[model samples]
Target: FQFCSTRHELGSIILTTNLDFDKWPDVFGDARMTEALIDRLTHRADIHVMNGESYRFRQTLELRKRVAKEN
Candidate 1:
């Protein structure tokens, strides 16, 4: 929180997480802290919620199917 509060304006940061803003407290284990952290992080951020199965998992299944066909 300290780094973000001080350095957020210095540059952009990229983060990936499955949890929504409302669920952040579950991960942080502190509602107040999560609120503060979210406030700072979202102040100048582009929030994108990605939905569905992970790309890597889908690709792995495709690879396995192809290998099975060849064998």
Candidate 2:
């Protein structure tokens, strides 16, 4: 209810989600919540699925090399 009602009233949102639509119900809890939420957002949203090796891990190695250069 909260998820659906707010977006309907406000008309826009920014959400960062790691799961695809098939997995939405797991987070939202049930079909009704998932259904209603998807209904509202689907019409106006742009889904961006980001895929690749994690930048967090890549950056850690890069940072280590930079620190070694400094030493």
Candidate 3:
């Protein structure tokens, strides 16, 4: 909270989170604070939402297939 507050309009912050805004309270443990943080972060920001399978998970599946074939 302090970090975002200090850098609210002073600098640029790149934040990447898998969870949605509504689920932030689960991680932050404070609904009000999470709301404030989201407000400050999105005030003058360009938001991007990327939806797809995780590269790591896909790679793991490929590795398991190769291992099973070799067995």
How many clashes show up per model?
0, 0, 0
Give stretches of model 2 more than 4 Å off: 63-71
Tens-digit per-residue lDDT, 8-69, candidate 2: 78777777877788899887789887888788777667888789978998999999999999
lDDT of 1 by residue, 19-43 (tens): 7889989887999988988888898
Local distance difference test values of all predictions, in order: 0.85, 0.81, 0.94
Per-prediction TM-score: 0.77, 0.66, 0.89
RMSD, every candidate, angstroms: 1.8, 2.7, 1.1
For candidate 2, what is the TM-score? 0.66
**Model 3 CA deviation exceeding 4 Å by range:** none
Local distance difference test, candidate 1: 0.85
Error of 1 at 54 (Å): 2.3
Order the candidates by TM-score, highest first: 3, 1, 2
Candidate 3 residue pairs that clash: none
Better model by lDDT, 1 or 2?
1
Query: Could you give the candidate ranking by lDDT, starting with the highest?
Result: 3, 1, 2
Q: Which residue pairs overlap in candidate 1's backbone?
A: none
